[model samples]
Target: MAQHALVTGSSHGLGAHLAARLAADGWKVTGLGRRPASETPGTPGVDHLQADLSRPETLERITDRLGEAPDLIVHNAVSYPPRPAHELSLAELEDVFRVNALVPYRLTLDLLAATPDTRFTSIVVINSESMFHADRDSGAYAASKAALRVLTGSLADACRSRNTAVATLLLGPLADPDKVAQLQRVAARRGVDEAEITRVFLRKSNPDLVIEELIDFDACYRSVQYLAGLGRAANGMLCRLDGGSAGSLI
Candidate 1:
């Protein structure tokens, strides 16, 4: 029987790439996202389910819809608000925490509750290096990710007896292909080079964000796959994907 995998935030970017790659590797893949796959033109072999992870009702329905327990579960959804911690509104803080930390916690618990005997083989959380390194502008985002990291560790402990390989891919900055393509289109319309556009975007957007350290989509796939494919021995592992910049001191 084919191993079934449930990947969240699969509408586009890294989630979409990972889901496609998993499907190609003969795993039965189901992708969950707020947007429908048809609108974004998702991978052919992977099944798509429309879901708003921030909504508890939607999450409950999704758990019910999942007939069989998935062998693997990938939590890749994130909510990033690039504002100072003091400037973040109550609504914004709530949103960031709900999507980044609460959703994954709720979803996993729901699955386990729905099927008491179901023991997931692997659980891969797409985390961020921001969790370790704090930024003045993106403090909320960093805090939320930090919460997720702690939650993932707690989950690892909870599932230790089940022999589930729970791991967090502590990713660095990523040059999302979807964002790049969109910028390319904008550049074409403005009759300017994409590099210039990228520079302006970096300047106006994330602070201290260097394009050089940004990992591509394929690298993320390899890291995620490596963690997911590991046996029980690799449980509670924190695999850092930063390009050796953070160093072993972390």
Candidate 2:
């Protein structure tokens, strides 16, 4: 049977890259996001749906788009608004929870419950470096992702007995265009030079193995596949995409 892959947040960043890579790997790929990934400049063998994961109805929208179940599922959409502790509002915090914690969780359980079969295979959740370690100002963003990491663990526990797969990929700061834009916005807001901001970011990203960090989407896919094939069902925990270090979790 042909492999069917579903990737959320495929309009850009690692999501887009993974979608394309899965297609190249000969899977029938479908993308879910607010924007359309199929309209992307040179992407072939990928289909997309305009489903905003922040909304409660999004999973249903995705299910409607799928028409039938897919074999592989990856949740990669992240919502990172300015999460200043002193000034952030209730709405902002709730939105962060909705997107970062609740939505992915709801989708995972609902999707898995709705889709029951070993043939369905793997489910991958994307967490961030911030998910493990907390920053003073990252209350909302970090808390939600931390919860997501917990849920990834929960799924691993629940699926392990059934011989299913659950994978968690903890990311460090990404160097994609959106991350650059976010950095620029931070610089503007803080009245700092863009170069200074870049320097700070790089310094903070220094790991024991810099070259091994910033793993490509193909590598990300392989990690998930490894976990899936292990029959352990509850394996493949990536604490920091920056060098795959356990230090980040501490």
Candidate 3:
């Protein structure tokens, strides 16, 4: 039988890219997102399940949507509110945490419960570098990611007995269009080009790093593929792919 994979937040960004890549790799991919599957950018073979993860009840029908248990589960859904620590309200914090941390926790539990006899080979959590390096005006996002990171550890421990590998991909700033636009705005404010700003960021973040400055969608997809292909020996490993910028912080 072909391997099946479930990827959350598959409407766009890294999640969409991973779903398409997995489909290209011959995995039966199911993409879960708030938007309809037709609206979500995915490969021809991917199955799209529209559900709001923040509402825990929406996940109850996930197993039915997916005909079989997933061999690989990638939690890539996230809520990012660019608010400073002092400006963050309780409601905003709760909203961010609900989507980023609580939803993933509940979804994973549901998956594990529904597939008690089936062994999942890999569970990849798409974490952020914000978990370690605190970016200005992103405290809420960072805090939620930190909670998810902790949850990843707990899930790994729980799945160890079943030989289910859990890998956390600590990613840096992805070169998505939104990120590029943000960089452009910052560059405009600093009276410099975006390229120069990126260069300075890379130099200041990790001067000794030898890899590329930014993490792109391709890099994330390859990392997930590698993590999902790991043998039992590499279970419960934290794979940092932040272009070596998280050197000392991690």
Candidate 4:
């Protein structure tokens, strides 16, 4: 049988791309997300599980849906809205943290418990540069991602003896038009020009970012696959996929 891989947040965007790539590479891929596969288009060979990570009832029974524990679990699901720390409400913070950090932590435990001791697996946690660098507007999202980094480290420590390797990827800026548009909306709200907001965002998030060519899905997928194949050797590793820009920074 092909190596089984379970990817969270695979309904769309980066998660979906990664799922497709994995399936194409001969891995049996299962996608877990809130959206049903019928309503949301997915890769041809990928299986999807519809579950809202925020709901405890659904999360509690998620393991029941997977017939076999996955050899690779990709925690690609994320909840990030551009909000300042002072503006983020407690409810909103909890909701973001639940999806971003808590879900991965819970799923790791659940999957490990279901797995037999004879098998070794890998868990890849997708993160952003914000995990290490703080931003003024996106502070709340950064904090949650930072929390995820810590949790992944703890998991690496706890699961090493069980032959479960865990790693976190701190990615630099990607070519996301949606994120640019989100910043544009913020600029509108602040009565500032879009260019000014974009400039400031680049300055803070990735000062050396090559504006013409940001990280693409292909590069990101390559990183994920590389880390996934490393297995036990990569436990507790924090790999940076920032193209020598932010990764090299002090």
Model number with the top TM-score: 3
Q: Would you list the C-alpha lDDT of every candidate in the order shown?
A: 0.80, 0.71, 0.80, 0.83
lDDT (tens digit, per residue) of candidate 4 on 82-152: 46777888887887899999989988998999999789888999987776667677778888888898899
CA shift of 206, model 4, Å:
1.7
TM-score each candidate. 0.83, 0.79, 0.86, 0.85
Candidate 1, superposed: residue stretches over 4 Å from native: 82-84, 114-120, 178-213, 245-248
Q: After superposition, how far is residue 163 of candidate 3 from its true place, in Å?
A: 3.3
Q: How many residue pairs clash in each candidate?
A: 0, 0, 0, 0
Summarize candidate 1's per-residue lDDT along 32-93 as a digit string, tens digits: 88897676456877889988776657766887677887888899988777578889888878
TM-score of 3: 0.86
Which 10-residue window in model 4 sums to the lowest lDDT? 241-250
In candidate 2, list every pair of residues with a backbone clash.
none
Alpha-carbon shift of residue 10 in model 2 (angstroms): 0.7
lDDT of 3 by residue, 1-250 (tens): 7789999999887899989999988998899888886788757878888988767577677777787778889999988775686687887778789889988877787777667544656788999877666666767787899999899889878877775777898887678878678778989999998888877767776564446456789989998988888855446788888776666645
Q: What global local distance difference test value does model 1 have? A: 0.80
Which is the better candidate, 1 or 4, if ranked by lDDT? 4
So what's the TM-score on candidate 2? 0.79
lDDT of 2 by residue, 151-225 (tens): 777877777655457787766555677767887999999999886886676656544334422445666666656
Q: RMSD for each model, in Å, please?
A: 3.7, 4.7, 3.0, 4.3
